[model samples]
Target: MHVTDACGRGGATPPSRWDPAEPDPVAGLLATARRRLGMDLCWFSRLIGGAQVIEACDGDAAAFGVHPGSTVHHPGPHRSHALAERPLPVVGRIRPEAVTSGTATEATGTAATGVEATGGPLAGRPEVGSYIGVPVTLADGRPYGMLCCLSRDADVAMPARKTRSLALLAEVLSASISDRRSGGEYREAAWWRIWRLIDSGGPTMVFQPVFDLPSLDCVGAEALARFPPGSGGAERWFADAAAVGLGPALELSAIRSALRAFTCLPPEFGLGVNASPATILSGRLADAIADIPADRLVVEVTEGDRVEDYPSVRCALGVLRREGVRIAVDDVGAGYASLHHLVQLQPDFIKMDQCLTRRIDADPARRALAAALVHFAQETGSLVLAEGVETARELGVLIGTGVHQAQGHYLAPPGPLPLPASANRTRPPDTA
Candidate 1:
């Protein structure tokens, strides 16, 4: 056996080690175990390719001749615990003869019978007088590492209760490590998926036409994104991208893809594209629509999280508004955030959420709310666009409530670009 202290001799650096300055769950648990066991040193050693690698430690590491990132070749408390088919007895007051070349105490009445010292707990560590440790296993029941406590005084007690406490702590630490590893692996996978999507030129764009409620003329189309097969729903894909810190990148990619609509849209009709508040503040949206005539674009702002700095948002939007790009406050009736956005943005359009428009003809409350929003939009110089007008009754109710525009499956579902011809109307529906 060979004992190598990496901190002093520059051996292989341990892949993972505890840093006292950082707040890590395993580090906290190791310190708690050492204090509870009343030991001078407590450490976790991961068995990597038959070598015990000191991954974490608490208390006096220098005195024990072992520090985090050190490696002990073989034959130590950790190795024995990991290999044992059953739990081994906690060795307290280890006899000198069993651990080192030192002579036995006169009181023990035994001669020196030192074991072959290779690279283990006792190699150049004759002062390690008491030892207690337990194997840490993964979810699959395979031994992953060992949590060990050591004391310099030979008379240090290893009570049954203390041994039990150490074992319980090892179990808790094992679960935490497993959970952290799982989360890390998931994030890694999500990162790669998003990378591939962006590299492939983003999501496919589909057009959902927004029609004038009375004339039924095709005024514009809202571009919606359709992700690759098996990538899950569009909303979830964007959400996962956000979780991996690629929210703005993914949104920008989608915007770029949706801009492809210009080739198919009629010259007279405009295009609407969705963007989150974060993306708007990034200062990239203006660049995306720079080449396209600004008057032909409508940026409908969608938000899952509230914006903390409204002044910054307004400043960013103000820059675009001056350049001919119109803004729409999306999902206005879904939550208070949309209402807040309307107050702050004073957008060109207010899109009532589908929930408020789904069955307004049958629900008097929804109808009343729609009327109130129309009045509000009128006061603010904003046009009310009621989304999800699936029936003639819904369309009639929306027009009667003074909604200027509408879109839903009833008019035409989202499909490949090339806007459908405007639906003809002999006369405007009677609002009376």
Candidate 2:
């Protein structure tokens, strides 16, 4: 029996913040209600998989032999009212007179803490006599569970106002649960879609040619991924895959698809594939590129995010390098993490971020940075490749800045290999 909040996902509550030690919003509400109503305990129990499990609680749970995750038996009638689909009257055994004078229903013979045959407020703990519970319902009018408060004393007066407040609290909990469940469902759907895509051999691969600025000759092509139409951009698809823990598999699939182009591309032209630190560290990337000619393969390590462990990534790349594959640090000058990566990875190529090249002809700041990166690359025995060059002016600026190579819409939009003649400046005449 998994104890979750009013929502169906497996957790006592949605995290209140980054810190797990902090009390969650559901727990805070339970505490406030418990103190205001003067109850010995207040807890939210979610009916998950047909078991009544405590998800969040406030007050001395141990005293009543219950805690979060404790599965308890509920009287059939009371439970029906608590989880009713409509706004029925609140159910309780608040006072001696209000107590349902009957032998408490027998408990289901399930293995659970604090569960017993006596269906009292605290189930096994017969000492709890004052109990008030309101149904928590989802937006779809389905019963989620109950918001309940109880006390050890039978004659405790649960005022009308307090009962109303409890109902309101339940309503708030219901809304939160509904919203969370909806988000969870959306993510699950997205995950399944990406999973199926990967299962079907990953996103379509397209190669955008990267050219040497001076010669304007086809040097290599960067492999870009293309998901199905209306599936959003390539970045979004990869993000969705990453969120669902399938990032590495999807990326490797893309790499494998890109490798297929090696059979079509001229031996002189190299192929650049994008990879994150995570995929590189997976230890499969080296194997993926092993069949291709080593010198004609470049792995562009994307710097959209920071790498957690540089030493491990360096070691991983080293393996690929030893086998003749080159490494390029991508999106340089776009962020501090990229700069940090440049220092740590010491890659064979430094690909300038598009932002720095977008309008370098007009922005002196951009030119200065581009020049500085080129100089840095020169000093470090690395080549600087300007990415995303979209105009003649930007291309001229990058060329004048001594960028070794460049790629973007200006160079060529990604398409099938064997570069389009319009984009191909000078292919080796001898190469077939």
Candidate 3:
């Protein structure tokens, strides 16, 4: 293969392998692998139009011709071709003499007479002293791409266990690609549906009351997105939008739709909106709610989105906080990272995960955890909100544990558009 540097000298523009608008979803995975494995460089390559193109990469390997948009022609001898044909993991030290002399190594299986004998593109790169790669294959056994790591030291050696771990990561990337590629027609139709929804002024918003535990009176309402008839659940629609690289646009549209309810809500009721950390950091949320009073808006950071940089997130949150926008760490107890978020961000609200509050009245263990979080919120001077309180017993338990606020069907189901004037006056069901 004719491996050429994308960032070549003389100011020549390199061809791009990915859609410029869409965020590289697997970029974080490659970065994590490089960091954990202590490799000089890490990258992912996909065979496109008969050539292997670098799609994503991280670390100093960029200096060694590893970069997005770089291409390696699938001709003659090359390690990438071998991996594509056999779909096996490759790891070994690169002999400088062998590479410069145009000799193919046993590990790469490149032809000795073709590109190797003529000093092909990959040859004469002294920086690449050692290399390791795992085939990223599709679910049906087709070679989709390759995950590779390289080092500058000739004697570098990776343990078999590490190589296996690398393979597992490749499997994950493969699965993600498979999911994006599968259901082609369905996804295309869904994409159009979502695009039309956003272009036509976005989805409708339903307000669900959040009640103060002691007073049993509405203190706020979380804006829930509801699509037009037959558009599917809000979650699925958003996921589909993200897979198609329209996540930020769709989310911004939804936020704008949700914010319109601020005028309809009572002055005493705060408005909570769900958003991913990426959306928050994008500064779009700040601009969307610029006209609205920040105290009235609670930006609940959604859980499970991998956060690579905590400092950047914290900085973003700080900017919003200064503008009176309150932050809420959503889905607490759903994952270990949630706890870390609570500690790091020190948000104004802590919304316990539904799984932990599902049956807290009957589960002592759940109650204890909820109680502890409530106490933590108290110490942090933040309000504790228990989500998905479906039973009077659960509501009673939440109140007893000093949870400041809550929202679920048991308190008040999400109300339709043009919410009734009494929506903010919703009271808890009579437990007596």
Local error of candidate 2 at 64, Å?
1.8
Candidate closer to the true structure by TM-score (higher is better), 1 or 3 = 1
Candidates by lDDT, descending order = 1, 2, 3
Candidate 2 lDDT, tens digit per residue, 1-432?
A: 233212122322222212344335797889988988888889898866445688888898876656777775554554554455443434344323223342232212111012222234344444656566676889988877878776776533446776788989888888887777776676667766776676677789888988887777778889999988987998898887676556777788898888999889877888899998888998988777767887789999987557888999999999999999999989998888888989999999999999998888899999999999989988999999999877777877888989999888766888886875345433222211
Candidate 2 local accuracy as lDDT? 0.74
Q: Which should have the higher lDDT, number 1 or number 3?
A: 1
Task: List lDDT for all candidates, in order.
Answer: 0.75, 0.74, 0.73
For each candidate in turn, the TM-score is: 0.80, 0.83, 0.59
Model 1 scores worst on lDDT over the 10 consecutive residues at 105-114
Which residue pairs clash within candidate 2? none
> Against the true structure, whose TM-score is highest?
2
Model 2 misplaced stretches (Cα beyond 4 Å) = 1-24, 48-51, 68-84, 87-91, 94-126, 154-156, 420-432
Query: Candidate 1: global Cα-lDDT?
Result: 0.75
Against the true structure, whose lDDT is highest?
A: 1
List candidate 3 stretches off by more than 4 Å: 1-190, 417-432
- Return model 2's CA RMSD, one decimal: 7.9
List model 3 lDDT by residue over 1-432, tens digit each: 222122121211222234355555698899888877777888888866555677788887535544677664433434445545655566766666766654424333222112232314455565456667777888888787778777776644456766877888898888878775665556566666766677677788888888877787777788888887765798888888776546766777788888988877778778888888777777667778889988888989887467889999999888889898899999999997788889888999999989998988889999999989988988989989999988788888898988988888876789864443332335655464
